[model samples]
Target: MKNLLDILSNPHKRMPLDTLMKCEVVLEKLDFKRSEGLPPSGAQGKEQIFNPLLEVVNKCLQSPLANHTLKRTFGSTLHALNGPEIKNLPPPAKIAKVEEPPMEIPDVLQGEIARLDSRFKVSLDTMQTLGSEGSISLFAELQSARLPCVPPLQVFVPRGYPAAPPAASVARAAHSKPDHFLKLLNKAMDHKCARLPKNCSVGQLLDAWEMSVRQACAPNATTANYAPVPALGI
Candidate 1:
């Protein structure tokens, strides 16, 4: 026992594999002998707390079985033995959660953002840059038209865009779709390059679907609205 205590006290003493096994056996035998005297499974008093009990605790902690159920039982016994005196150990500190940094907007894409904000009156509130190459989301709401709006639609614009038309679609359901919002996405898309003047923006293709939604849902849109009928004599 003195050798074991000396070895535990000296950091330089590396116990051999066989000696470590012997130490575990000695601790188990010692615990089995003293467990009968501890608190009788519930009661605590002056008789229960003693130096010999704490010596068993240090032994149990050093044993190879420290992570097992037997070690857990020993831990409970140790806690009872120490009682209010356990305040010597400080409570553990909590770790705060780390959040991802804000998304970045590119210098080249700033022009596109400006065009949408100034001309269409859409702003960054409706858009998000995907990555460094100016890939972005188009806020699919009809800001000028007072209509039931769908969720924000993500427009995937590859590094080289407007050479080909951009694609748009709805986002994942927030568990399910938002109130009054339909999954009216993944619908067919087209362009009016022939009718419109040339050389505006290559990224203009990204806004084509947004324009179509605004035109179709506007209160005075010709297709979805009717002129007031002539009143009959009352």
Candidate 2:
């Protein structure tokens, strides 16, 4: 036992196979030296904690039939007779759970945006340069460009009646024949007949329809002279 303890206390004894083989050797040597009888069953008692081999010791001490089984033949021969049963050993104490510290998360979006901007090879200077080029012209050239100060506009607000809807007058004109529609069309095209493009079919059709109605009927256009529109400015 003293030799086994000395060998186990060495720092170099690390491997499981080495420890198991050494323990087997110790048991075998102890058995050869002692030659004790096998232990009986129900041998549980106090001394099994420090030297657990005592539990095996108690078993070898208690077995009745001396026919020499492994535990009876070998184990009784190994260690001392005063050892206790292994199953009677006390359980290890419960350990407390440890609480971990909180971790801080990094801003993933900011990192991704910065990476994208670098990969695209873009700078703020290029955006400002584009904005300056598209600005509108604020001043005209120093030439007498004849801007129309007075356009030919006649806005007459008569005494009291409201103007009839253009829709009603158009409805009446729509009932006319295709030939009458053509004469009014020819008159509207008198000056612009040569100037118009050959592909201006839609514009030509609209002018012809407008001329077809000689006078557009206005039920609400009439105004009494009593309620007059006062002139504001020329």
Candidate 3:
């Protein structure tokens, strides 16, 4: 305490790293004990949490404090720590940060889209990005029999695929059914599908939806289409 006081009291004085570390160990033990003695909940938080911490701090203050810049800081710190907010105990739950897994192209899914383009009229293209995270655009002629209307779909497949579904969307808003498509897409490609008939690739999901969309949007589709409105002469 004297060493800490001496160092902080003098603007030119700085505590050695080792000495600070030693003090930290002692202070941490005192703090932990003080916290343990506090109310499990808010047993009148001020008396339970703040008062105990304040008392420990006061004992340190009783030692002669130099009238330096650090003196005002010390007083403020004690008051702030023991102020009104101290009564309520901090919640026990520790928030854990979930880091997204690095983007990986599964061997089964990798280069699979290329093989797909070779078989069907659909083409897969990569768009320019400002990041290392990559995306793909899939499309085909709407007149094609294999895929009557393969609207261009773009999806970001950064690290944390499968566990974190790809960020997906279509080129044309009028051609997209985002909510339905994304839900089905996630279900199809979810790597964590614990049931049988295993999860598939993003490309496959896109392809399946393309076929579904084409069928649903066929000129003869029983699902009534919204009538086109005439544009006014400009």
The local distance difference test score of model 2 is: 0.31
**Could you give the candidate ranking by lDDT, starting with the highest?**
3, 1, 2
TM-score winner, 1 or 2? 1
lDDT of 2 by residue, 1-234 (tens): 433343334424333444545666766655432333444334534322325354444454466742344443335334445475467667888898865433221243224224542212211212222223221111111111222111111111111112210100111234555453333323332323333343332223223233222211122322231233221211
Q: What's the lDDT for all of these models?
A: 0.46, 0.31, 0.47
- What are the per-residue Cα lDDT tens digits for candidate 1 across 1-234? 444554544535555556655656775665444655554533544434433544655676678865773433334444555674534667788888876556564455566656554334433433453344455544433354444454554554444444433344545556874332141222212223222333335345435545555554544544223233221100
- Residue 69 in candidate 1, Cα distance off native in Å: 44
Compare candidates 2 and 3 on TM-score and give the better one: 3
List ranges where model 3 is wrong by over 4 Å.
1-109, 117-127, 133-143, 146-150, 173-200, 219-234
- TM of each candidate vs. truth: 0.32, 0.14, 0.30
Screening candidate 1 with a backbone cut-off below 3 angstroms (N, C-alpha, C), the clashing residue pairs are: none
Residue 18, candidate 2: Cα error in Å is: 1.9
Q: Taking the tens digit of each residue's C-alpha lDDT, what string does model 3 give over 92-182?
A: 9988997755434556446554576543444444344323464433443234555434345555444544544444444555756666444
Model 1 alpha-carbon drift over 4 Å, by segment: 1-87, 117-119, 123-136, 142-153, 158-166, 170-188, 191-202, 210-234
Task: Using TM-score, give the best candidate's number.
Answer: 1
